[model samples]
Target: MRARDLVTDFPTVALDTPVHEAARLLAAQRLPGLIVVDERGLPSTILPGTQVLRLAVPSYCQEDPALARVVDEEHADRFLRSLDGRTVREALPRKPRELPVTDPDATMLEIAALMARTHSPLVAVVDHGRLLGAVTLQVLLDQAVGT
Candidate 1:
């Protein structure tokens, strides 16, 4: 099967966007991370769950409980800080900024290798250099389920 069929309508964020909005998306949608996309709507990188933690915790104590407390105590502050106007570009990792891509005709092995090399859970589904969707580990595992 093709990646297009596997894409799971996951959440997205802009690269230059502030760290805050992604946090809210995680809280509201209960997602682990968001796909950071460019202005053209192409994904630039995957913003892992941990980055949001850094933004939530204080510099001295960066623990989950403390961060959760910060959230509880500073909902307004955090909300105001989130993706207020920034794009994903500014926040994208300097390393491996884009998800690995392959033609629709490529085999799952090729895509899997790409994912493995990059250590990314997802591979952006592209066609002729255009963003289409993404394939993730969950989708791959789903096929093996119930068998």
Candidate 2:
């Protein structure tokens, strides 16, 4: 199958969107990630849900595994409050990883390889610099297994 055939509805957010709001969307929809669009509404980056969780989680918890047990859901929720004033662009790494993108005509193998190489959960299908939609890992897996 081609990328165009696999494209499906996906969430998108602006670069200036509040981090907390983006996080809520990710959680509410159980999305793998969001397509971050530039001011011109062009897909510029991919914000993975894991990256949002990384920001919510405390460094101490990551560094010292024991500290994680001390953190309850309430505490974790409070920690995410720090994202209130931050924008999605601010949450991204200074040197963000490359976004995985494919043309509509790309084959399934090509899309899968790009996702694996970029370690991305979704790949955007662009047509003449415009984002058509995204192919998620679940979709790819379903196609692979003939589901």
Candidate 3:
């Protein structure tokens, strides 16, 4: 199947958006992640739920002193880890070394190769220089292991 077949055309967030807002969006939609975008309409990075969780802890600690140190240190550590040596353009991956990408006509086999090589959960699907959506490995496995 084509990447577009399982791709999710969801809303994106900007880098400057408050961590709280980003977390709300993910929770409201029950989504795993959001595509973080730059002003030029190009994706900058992928902000996954884990990033939101870390951000939330600090904000939540505001009302409870007990949680303050927890977020400030533990969760703060996670945020730093999420951005570990990452440039503004790096797509977050289970494996951050190589990027997984495909064109409009890429077949399942082509994506599988890239996924194996990059250990990517999601592969960016582009059409004529524009990002359409991402084909995630989880989606493929879900279909293959359908109930």
The 0-to-1 C-alpha lDDT of every candidate, in the order given, reads 0.64, 0.88, 0.63
The segments of candidate 1 whose C-alpha lies over 4 angstroms from its true place after superposition are 54-90, 96-98, 145-147
In candidate 3, stretches whose alpha carbon ends up further than 4 angstroms from where it belongs are 57-100, 109-121
Q: Write the per-residue lDDT of candidate 2 for residues 18-103, one digit (tens) a residue.
A: 99999999989999998998876667888789888787777888789798887787876588787888899888878968779889
Q: What would you estimate as the lDDT of candidate 2?
A: 0.88
lDDT of 3 by residue, 28-61 (tens): 9776667677787666666667655544344455
Worst 10 residues of 1 by lDDT: 56-65
Could you tell me the lDDT of residue 21 within candidate 2?
A: 98
Q: Which candidate tops lDDT?
A: 2
Residue 78 lDDT in candidate 3:
56
Backbone clash total, candidate 3? 0
TM per candidate comes to 0.64, 0.93, 0.59
Candidate order, lDDT descending: 2, 1, 3
Off by over 4 Å in 2: none
